[model samples]
Target: MTSKLTTGRAGIRRGAAAIATAGLAAASLVAVVPTPPASAGVGKAGASPQVPQSPPLPQSTQYSADGWKARPEQYDGMDIERDVPITMKDGVKLLADIQRPTRHGKVVPGRFPVLVQQTPYIKTVLSLPPINWALVKRGYVIVTVDVRGTGGSGGKWPVWGEPEHSDGKSVVEWAASHNRPWSDGRVGLFGISYGGINQLFTASQRPKGLKAIAPAVPMGDLYRDLVGKGGRGYLELAPAYLAAVSGLGILPNTNLLKDPATALKNIQEHWDAAAGNLKMIPEMIQGGDRAYDSAWYRERSPLTYVDRIQVPTLLMGGEFDAFQRGTPMLYQRLSAKGTPVQFINGPWSHAIAAIPAAGVSLPGVINEPPGVKLGELQLRWFDHYVRGVPDPALDRRNKQVTYFENGANQWRTARQWPPADVRYQKAYLSGQASKGRPGALGTPVSGTPDTVKWNLFSGLCSRSTFQWLLFGGEFGNGPQKIPCMTDNRYNDQSGLTYDLPVRGRPLRFTGPVNAHFTVSTKSRDSQLTVRLEDVGPDGSAIQLTAGWLSLSMRELERGRSVVRNGMVVQPWHPYTKASQKPMPKNKPVTVDVEIFPASWSVQPGHHLRLAVQTGDFPHLFPPFPQLKDSFGGDVKLWHDKTHPSWITLPTQPS
Candidate 1:
């Protein structure tokens, strides 16, 4: 915290101030004493958070906990069979790499619980299943498959289309029945990102013998989570990811080596498939305005059919992840239904999701994001749910919710998300910009309206760039990490910034944030971008999380929004074309934008900031059709007695 090196968004993580918080223990939970305020950071007062790292992923690490490392590996080595083809109902062949424990370089004579990960990314690039030695050695069967029309698999990539849904059920049944020699009938699903999401699709089918799933960093709602989060399209990530996967789809799969003639035909099929998906790239932008939240996304998002999935589920999420909104939503829904579930959320972004992995280190390394190893935790989860091994760790009463509080730099356990102790507090927008400073956040007052040009590159150079862009083999630290993730001063300049008056008292908050604004626009529509940040004493500000909303989609689903302690803690929105409404030019419109959740503490010298913009691009932009409605024009922000614009933050007790 004392470094004051806030040049990059990924700058210093350690905090100089200290605050007391509680930590979760293996068998119990207790209060933790204050430590030096080296916190989760980026900005003026922090040194670069990037750190040197190498070696094993967390899934392969051994934990120091009592029963964690106690289970010895049943086998010494592993046997991997690549390009194992399984025929679907339509006669399309999907390729999978199967890994089993080996003894003396030979397959062990035993039936092991099967773990499956279906992905669109090339099968050779391992992440979701990680494909490390530690897992197979511990007496489990690991299966990684390239989804239809991708990798070595035959048929077209469904983009989570119809084929993709049924394909998961087929793959699960295939693993449980076709791989009988190594399978024990009991099966589980595990993977990160693409690999992670397919688990929801497959499990939702109520596939037989699929006992449990561990979907790490998966999106629950494709539309609200990533594609067009808060009614806006992901400008760079959607197309880039589609292109990356489609390009990989055409790679000469290893199947070409096994059968040259047949492989060539399939390779051509891959390109044919890629060509079909590539056409959707431009359509993504058009869909942003016209077809956003269309039937296409509803069919793909797991939220549409989550209730159908009854299996025990484990979710690992990043507070700064692209799917941060969806992760907790999934947890809340499942836990509400009294289903078996566990959610472990940390202070990492999309690419940095594994920062707490077994052998890695970055920020918030106190008790956890890792006290025991992440790999062992999964092992225990599956042991109880899938392998029929009774474990106390599986007890639902124990910390079902484990989260990392960044500024505190410690991982704590809770019975539920937003924990039961949370209370929402409102900070009204007040004052006006003077000199170089923007408006202030303080007690409600009838302040004169402020005007500024709509911001298109609102978060262009901030944490969000890192959160949505980086995918595989990415680290939160080091030179490879994007500088924007560490700082937000660049974007703050383009918007109307409001800072909570520095009260000289520490303030702690976590969970969802709702930014309510009363504004007038010259255009018929506008996009609202709100970022929740923590500003340092030296004027450097770092982004905690952000939210977006196209004005046309401002309508809220009031009955669906949650009210706790008399404040709408979490606002639900129907970002559908049918819900779209026209805004009157030069008239005030009430808009509630849901800020993605985060966990952090405002230290004594630091303050909280809410930066608001009229529009954002490269991060999220309206479709071409809606450009006329949202394209740049000055916006009027009103903070008056009749239209008191404010932000609601879920404050948590220390």
Candidate 2:
């Protein structure tokens, strides 16, 4: 069955918000914090938008870096310093807002360590959060800046380029040297998404006085994470992300907010101004020859310079995030270099991690999940690095890999990723695709070839991206509200599936899933997408994780590839213009697919199933549409001893 489109109120609201008018110059930066929030609520003057009241947050207690319990509301109120200017190496001035702890009007006397966050999403967006309040109460000065461009900050954003690196360094240095009364010269970086990306850029530069960084759900490689994963552009979400960035142009100017009323006025003005068009940014990026890793993508990606990062880093990822593969890769590289680092892979999605429901707060927005612990985690990391506080949980001398297992609903820790104790178990594919029984995965089955047909535009981004965008955060839809795969019956019947025998006991698969297939297609070029599912006795299929490969881009970088149990850990591909070549005519080729990493426990009575198809629509643009590509006919799959096809699961020993 084909996917249906739902353009309801959310879609209409998003459409209205994304359309920006022409020739609106960026707003001017005001040099002082607006007078304290007005005591009385006020309405808008003229047609401007009405000011929004501060969002309400439930009263809650949080743990300090050194493990102390304290409520954010009980802490000393903060002193606000807005639109402060910091000059960069190139003389560009970025605007920043500083919030420091205060007791009865005097800046808390002693010098304190500082926590910095830089974002393209106006700095004012974070001004009212208890998240910042908690940090300031813990005796840390919080400085939030508008990353160059987009927020009264000078200079163009360069879309995540060198400017981010240079500006971040300057900001860290500025926070260290300028806070004579309130800071002792040490600073740590933190933020989510673009904020996370900025931290990576700054840490790579190794700015002096920079203590450490905690980047959540960051983009490790732009091309791999967004534009193209396995050589195909992730069409739907990429454009939406670009549109979100463009919308920032119309957001209320944080530097100009004199009070909540004034801020609301500005917000309405901007929203009203964005009524005609706002697709320019995304169009420009996608309009280029984007089939491969173009220069624009490489320059913005942190994967190129991550090796230079030397500071202690805390990296976090959500199992369902659009960019989930990133943090794990960062963890692996950092650990390989013996750099102090910690990694947490939770069962959240991009929204859940970005706009957390608990412990964190965004102005006028509240979707917090009760009893959240990420704030505590962040506090511990900063305390260990900035304050030199001691805590076994954040100790660099100890193992620090942590993951949340979904089916089991439990957290597990390991010294290294994928937990070195995992052993690879193989399940071979066998069955007649046309005969109607789901293909079976058995122990080294010897059989003839089977064929399956797939149309590229069938599924909807695997339901992860849409879930995050429409919902406030990843968990916005709540448990049982949004599922990764819906029912899976139609999809499994439409494609090729190899079902494993029912399990007699529980099985925990804690790492990457690898698949090897020997096949040939009549089509000039074909893309292979592999999905892993947990099938219950009732035949319900739950998607675990998936991997993709572009047949033409399958030339592996032999020296860079690592092989274990005959499956490449990460099949390294050149994906360069010179390395692109069509598959041999009707000749069988062996291709390895490295599925995204996952942590899941399969219970007794459940069986594992593998599904292979040529495309997952509205997620990644199909290769056929761009190049007018199509398979010659039914794609042939070989499974005899001469050309055995199997999948290797990283299972933890029982």
Candidate 3:
């Protein structure tokens, strides 16, 4: 088998001066070598060069035969390594490539703590080598271990964080005990996405010598973040994640099944089967026993242990990432419980973490934060916490809850999340042709419309259905909108729009979102969809967050539901079996739609837009395919001084 490194649009190249300085500093690190043979010849549109296959090294070897070594040419005077395997207690051997200064035979005066990252993404010889080398030169040991069942490890793959955390904990302990030159008892964990979540899981367990963790773009809840809520799933995220993981699971030298050919075939077969039966993958992968049968899923979930986390943690996520809701929940819980947590978020996707976002480009790769610099941040974090370095950069005062404003490229930080002193404002949705203006009043009422009716047949199509056709079928073929809105053409009022003008200085909303109104359906049961957006000066609407609720399951648990800002706030609650009670048709009832929590700043000129439709395409799977009693034939929203319809927001006071 042959492998090559492609310096695509994403790879970073250092200047001569930087390389020379790195070389001198990394002299005591691991001996440097040329770019790993795996990264050589793999370029944009270029075929990978063939290389001889060598026998697997024995477990007794301190590092894999292809382990971390210096590569002078790859990075001027930098040391590099690749495919170093480490064995864990459960006989699950994992691979990690190390990069550090070549030990100059003299006892290094002080032992440096290790910066560890465990991810499912393959750390190719070229991709992460510079990062490791940079850390080594900076007097730190950098270890990049592939998570269990992904790269050179034994075990069946469970999507997301579960098994990875266990593997990470084991690796941290092993690195501490190993007799390597820089192997001190202290360890710091860092990474993005699955890599990020693992840090949280590992830290929550409060590992013996674990000092600190930096989990960027970290996922918070599994079921809510991954599956769906209010009986709907974020269609695109689940399938895309499964596809990506399937690819990662088939990487060379990672599977115990040995031959990449056979492994790829097996993975493809499983993936194909999964595609055919989407609902069964979770249960099938989990196997027979319900309790702990899916230990991986249970272990990967941070919600299972949020109150237990004690270490100071730095959590980051993207404003639009699938797991955005989870980050705040995790941060709030840990911080309020006095866990010393800091949160940072940006407008980045998962892939951008390892490639630089500005200026430099790797031929075919998306610009992500370069692995080398991310490693440096990890080093600084470790230096301050593990080594007690007293670096001003790692001081608590310098770190806070920072986020990116959609239109603003600059970053903003606040002492606390959901900033304090935000005013809760109300806006009424009335039916009228106002010509794009607010307060175009129709008759306002204190309760829902007396004879509000909607056609049940109209709610058949949804965002999930359209997405299924787009990505799974033909619509995904050509150039499409990058952040496309899910299609909802079949539902009533599909093009419905609502606008609320800003009343004061740029309004910053941070916290749970709510839409409150009295609703009545022509049928016994119905569904309602609500969306929140920020409308730009040019009339372009950017979706901030959304929510949905099935009236049938509107039974709220005691103490979990609160009425605020004219809307009902439903805290996180597990779904319970549906009740057998029946309701009279055409009766008016109060319903609260709770959207996901988000942080967004509505500029002075921009308007807060709320679009109310009976359906949200692709955002969720339609409650029932049969369309039996699902739509409320006619619906009326009442808003006025007495029954003022409004959206509640967590406002931070300036």
Candidate 4:
């Protein structure tokens, strides 16, 4: 905290400084205490080591706690150094909390590899996941730095902008320098969500001394993966994001005056400034603007500059993670360029990405099953790169993709994404959902056409009971919001359901799902939503993945699309304003929608269902207010030979 650093925002009050210091040390739920583990000494070199049990964590924040505690901290003799100041190249000073191995209330004498995590979330509060203790005990120095504008740092918080990136490089270089205690000048990056995204962009700069990064459930593109999807903004989620960041008060004007009483006057000033910035966030994200691929959005997206990353990386997440789309694309781009990288997708959600393989549930509210833990794998990765410990298993695992297949509830390794053995199959759509018989999915049986209609007022938001993972807890207790796996019969009644008859044998599916349709509507523009569901024998429906496309943004760049095994894996679409076209009355138009990727197993006798609807409400604002009521009475769909409408599944052999 002593380093002389410039305050980039407004001047800070020195006495007001004590406010942040007190906040960091207060007994609020967010306070982080780096409690040492059971004193278990290490065995001989290469000897079987005893697993260090994680210290008891607060139950309220168990998700974040368990996330940190999921992995055993092998090293028990560790100590924390709080509020260390780090100077950025621009002369702005950031704050960091370091955890290092210690003995007899003193630092252990040794140069160890460093792992840096830059977070807007308070570094001292959220830094020590249970895994960091284990890492420190195993001879690593873990530095959790508060990004500019947040924590107790001296600067205007710029969020994920250039200031944060520049500060990140400076922090890494400083940690790698010889002056820091216990650091060997080698650094690796790690974090989840916001923490994870910072790592990706920071590593893209390829700062001196940065050796590797392991980002879990990171948003590859801010516009596409974070604020919106398929060119549409997440109306409800965007405001929620703003509220959470504002609640943190992480970015206050830090320009401090020397006098204590004078400094207190600036507290209100800081509050006002923070509030103003929060107000601007919605506009900054273009939350209400119906524009895609804008220069403002592109500048905030890592997708545009990801090619600059040169460090080895481990992209990790759950199959159902909110940030799922971006990671796979990043993995593919990096792998194709021969940058050392690996991807691990599991059956968990964004909150529990780091939960241990043996899941723990707390009472009736929190029900969790065994999940993939990255602690051990991370240790191995850093050990090899930072400590010179060669691991053949890491090498082999990286040669292909490693993911946990849901339904099967087991981990599977594949040579390529979608797996090399995947067989993409198409199921044609037919019949009427409103009819008692509903619709059937099968081979073209007579090439007959069918139609179903829903008024804009009739559509219900099909969010299911699943709480968004990002909104859930951070570490240990895991997300209190488990995806609602309950029967969706009631929900299916709200949309058009096309069910496949009972399967003769178990059908396992992996990777992305595609839905192609030929439809016509009287409205000038509309939104067509498609959802994948698993129908059990009892008639209960398990919702799977869903896809959405604003009718106007349906123009696809087919030639630029990615095709695998003659099937479109990722269809490139020009969602820009220029490519937008209106739908003419009764004029059939072909459209392709890419559903979210998934790994699910349909048991024998169970069925698969494709639910199509005009729109989903609340979750997304129904088109623009001006176009909300433009359903134009009725919508029509065709399945004749001339217009074969079908849903494609990426299937794996039984």
The local lDDT score (0 to 100) that residue 305 gets in candidate 2 is: 79
- Global lDDT of each candidate: 0.69, 0.64, 0.50, 0.60
Q: Order of all candidates by TM-score, from best down to worst?
A: 1, 2, 4, 3
lDDT of 4 by residue, 396-436 (tens): 65646777766666777786777888888888887655643
lDDT of 1 at 23: 7
lDDT of 1: 0.69
Any runs in candidate 3 off by more than 4 Å, and if so which?
A: 1-83, 102-111, 123-127, 130-133, 160-163, 254-299, 351-379, 406-411, 431-495, 503-505, 522-526, 558-570, 578-584, 623-644, 652-654
User: Lowest summed-lDDT stretch of 10 residues in model 3?
Assistant: 28-37
Could you give me the TM-score of model 4 versus the true structure? 0.80
Evaluated at residue 47, the lDDT of candidate 2 is 32
TM-score of 1: 0.85
Query: Model 1, residue 498: what's the lDDT?
Result: 83
Give lDDT tens digits, candidate 3, residues 263-346: 455455444534543444443223212111134445657767778878778776655555656777788778788876677666
| Model 2: number of backbone collisions | 13
TM-score, one value per model: 0.85, 0.81, 0.70, 0.80
Task: Return model 1's CA RMSD, one decimal.
Answer: 12.7
Q: Please report, as a residue range, the 10-residue window in candidate 4 with the lowest summed lDDT.
A: 35-44
Q: Which predicted model would earn the best TM-score?
A: 1
lDDT of 2 by residue, 261-355 (tens): 53454445444433322443344334334557667677788877788998898887778776677678878888888889888777766655654
| Candidate 1 residue-wise lDDT, 1-654, digit = tens | 011111111321121111010000000000000000111111122232233211122232345443444366556666666677777778887777777666676666656677877766665444112233445767777777778888777898878777877878877776665235556567888766666677788888887778988777778887888778777778867777778778877878777878787678878998988888888778867754334777788888878877888999988888877788888888888888877898989766555553332112334432344545665567777777887765664573443898888776778788888888778889999888532477888789788888766767666666666666644224225422555556777677777788885565667888999888898888877787888888887777788888888888888988988877767767788888789887788889888888888888888778788887766667777776666777766678899999889999888765
Q: Which residue ranges in model 2 land beyond 4 Å of their true spot?
A: 1-74, 105-110, 178-180, 250-252, 255-288, 355-358, 361-372, 434-436, 464-486, 623-627, 631-634
